[model samples]
Target: LYGAHLEGADLSGTHLEWANLSGTHLEGADLGGTHLEGADLGGAYLDGEISFAPAILRGAGARDINLEHIQCETFTEAFGDASVTLPDGYAAGEGKLSHWSPEKLDWENFYEAWRKWQAEQHPDLLPPYYTAED
Candidate 1:
């Protein structure tokens, strides 16, 4: 269904795992309980009543994509491009929003920033490199 216009379609409880719905227009579609794990939604125009939780958006294009309304929190491969707009309190290379690409870093305090970010994003997880000490 690459680039197919399925706007306002009632697709609830459907299993569309790993389907190539790249660039598809899914505005106002009833995607509740729809399984889009490992699906390719690159460059897709998505808006209105939909949830993408637990969906493996690995390597999916994030150009002009906004997840503030969806509240997605999954990470895998390349997820952001130049036009990617993430939710509040989220950066390109942070927890559940790690971008598989080089981005601007606070070179002088990269480590400290990373540590702070980890703590803020995932306080329950262990530190990087499995260090017990903070």
Candidate 2:
């Protein structure tokens, strides 16, 4: 399925043994308790933007995949007895591996500032709560 959005689909506790799920957009899919034994998830985007923020990969085997750019809080409970092949520079551990803030990046900050400035030019679109008496 090209450019198909499969967000929030509950495929949990299903026996998908040896399934071919290459190049599928599984954004926000509930895969908890799903038996994905010997399944190939190569080049799959877990969070769409290279994020490892505690995906619902509980009881799924994610062996031999490039997970270098994934930034999660922890992967202790997710990857249980699974052979997960991460990228070269990343190691599985507890804590923040990467931090993404809109205020930190120069380009993002400038773009956000410009957007805010553009939005303020229109008075009608502005929320009424901001002009309310304190």
Candidate 3:
């Protein structure tokens, strides 16, 4: 439903996996327990109240999405990963999404900071963040 307007729609538990919701208007839509995994929400206007968990947005594309007025079910629950780029004004702290008004660093810089800290404190474990395994 890309670019569609579904204002005030009761869409709880909808299986919207991989839907192209770019530029869509979902103001006041209920998305509780909705499966939005791998969905593309780029440029979507999402000012509605949503009941979301961190896994709800796993692998979802949310670049430039407007979540300025969105109220999730809980706060500080880790949401997206490195691929899911969050918008400005919102930040992923401790794996959860919250409003952070401080200077932000890109992923590479953040990773480098972590690596530097690891190299200084724990030199033995100063290596790749994860092992290459399939």
Highest-scoring model, TM-score: 1
Q: lDDT winner among the candidates? A: 1
Candidate 3 lDDT over residue span 1-134, tens digit each: 98999877877888886677878888777777777655656667766464353336444544454454554323222123233334454465432443221234454453444334334544444333323220
For lDDT, candidate 2 versus 3, the one ahead is 3
| lDDT of candidate 2 over 49-96, digit per residue (tens) | 433333333222233344544543333223211123444544433223
- Kindly indicate the candidate among 2 and 3 with the higher TM-score: 3
User: After superposition, which runs of candidate 1 have C-alpha atoms over 4 Å from their true positions?
Assistant: 53-64, 74-82, 99-134
**RMSD (Å) per prediction:** 10.1, 17.3, 9.3
lDDT (Cα, tens digit) per residue for candidate 1, span 1-134: 98999988878778775566768888777776676544545557777466454444433334445555655565343345324455677666566565422353332243344334435544443222435354
Which structure is stronger by TM-score: 1 or 3?
1
lDDT of model number 2: 0.40
lDDT of each: 0.54, 0.40, 0.51
TM-score of 2: 0.38
Q: List TM-score per model, in order.
A: 0.57, 0.38, 0.53
